[model samples]
Target: MIKDYVSDITFQNLSHKHMSFERVFRNIEQFMEKDPTGNFKLMFGTDSQVFSRETRFITGIVIQQERKGVWACFRKVTIPRRMTNLYERISYETTLTEEVVALFTDEKKDSLIDIVLPNIYKGASLSIEGHIDIGSGKRNKTSIFVKEMMSRINTIGLKPKIKPDSFVASSYANRFTK
Candidate 1:
């Protein structure tokens, strides 16, 4: 069932609905809360880093499932005025499946995390294991890479622009590689 939704999703074309960070996180939080299993955890954090001679904000959110003494956790790192991606490798447990492994690889190579800023969205994919796990009580700390792309869309409305073909066509500057 999850795979069906995953396959149907054109991740690159997420509607650019102009929403407050609070609204975005709140919507995501609500979605996570509807888990069938009565086990969910949410935490938010913030940090600062220097970029191009200026300090910028990096916000992170962690969601986890703890049931039957097992745990599955996914962390999303986002920068204000920038979109997020899950293509880099962080850390993960050894007991993982091929499909999950492939997902990370594809994400690194061909997936768009989020579209942020003017004409820029973060992109890249890396293979990190032991950070993202499926089923029961497991702990993984996978690191994903995100890039900023330059484009011509103003993502500030509830019905944000979503054009995958055009989005993938834009050029990126200083794309980070591993």
Candidate 2:
């Protein structure tokens, strides 16, 4: 059973009325075909905001091609009120990102993988980046978990990016969590 159900997702920059996980991959492929020369980066990230009764988690997938702007999709999930610890919240956010990545990777296994694999393995500059909300700034409380969270993301074979650089989480998804 899917414990964390995703409700009401949409691609922020697309005109399409409805968007699903499969559609997200399809849109990326179509974008690649339309602009073969453009440098493309796929990013996945999650952020959360706590309310009095629940915690809202927002996960986003962004496809960016150099100079051509960006296309993104987001899903929001709400869970019952829980712990307020910073570490626990960050860890939960990471888990949400991992879940999204797994779902997308699994969906890409049959058709999209063949097309994406070449770009990925042939040094074509195409890659996937996992953006974490943690930062290294002195004023940021999440900074302390940078190393540990980065290590976790690295173990999953994703290029991890922390704040100042992790806009997918800190900016895009963060907006929806509110």
Candidate 3:
């Protein structure tokens, strides 16, 4: 079974047992090798759902390769620390996404960096994006933090995605958090 702490984090493929981080990277490498011309994007995002006593945070790492489709793995944590403030909650979510990105980028494999395409200029490069669960829609108060969160992501040299576009967080991670 999957645990809620990073130290015990496990990623699954289909119905099989959870795989370690190293194995996950190896799988991604093999997938890329099989499709050299595939358009790939490596995105990290997190979303949270608060309950009465604790909050659940789910972070997801998604590999989106054109034609090959999308593959994602997630780890979740249920914390007793309740974040009643909206800003605090959003910041925590961003931090979770950042942590996941750091784990992937800090890997010893140099080739992993080449797969992270941050811009179009890099030929067939894999882009690493942070999908923030904020939007510009007036109905949602979270929209107010879009600029602030975007700036934070930009300062870290990563592309930021808001709602309607931040499916990795608002959609993928959201499913597990609930």
- For all predicted structures, in order, the TM-scores are 0.25, 0.82, 0.82
Off by over 4 Å in 1: 1-17, 66-178
Cα lDDT tens digits, model 3, 1-178, are 2224444666664444577776777777876666655678777788999998999998887888866788778877678977789999999899877766656654533575544444335456566688999989989999889998888777666789998889999999998887
lDDT of 1 by residue, 71-115 (tens): 222212223332222221111111111222233333322322221
Model 2, span 1-178: residue lDDT tens: 4423433344443365457666777787887667555677889898999899899988888888877888788767788995489999999899888877876554563344455555654544467889999999999999889999998878776799998899999999999888
Q: After superposition, how far is residue 21 of candidate 2 from its true place, in Å?
A: 1.4
**TM accuracy, model 1:** 0.25
Give the count of colliding residue pairs in each prediction: 38, 0, 3
User: Which of candidates 1 and 3 is the stronger one according to TM-score?
Assistant: 3
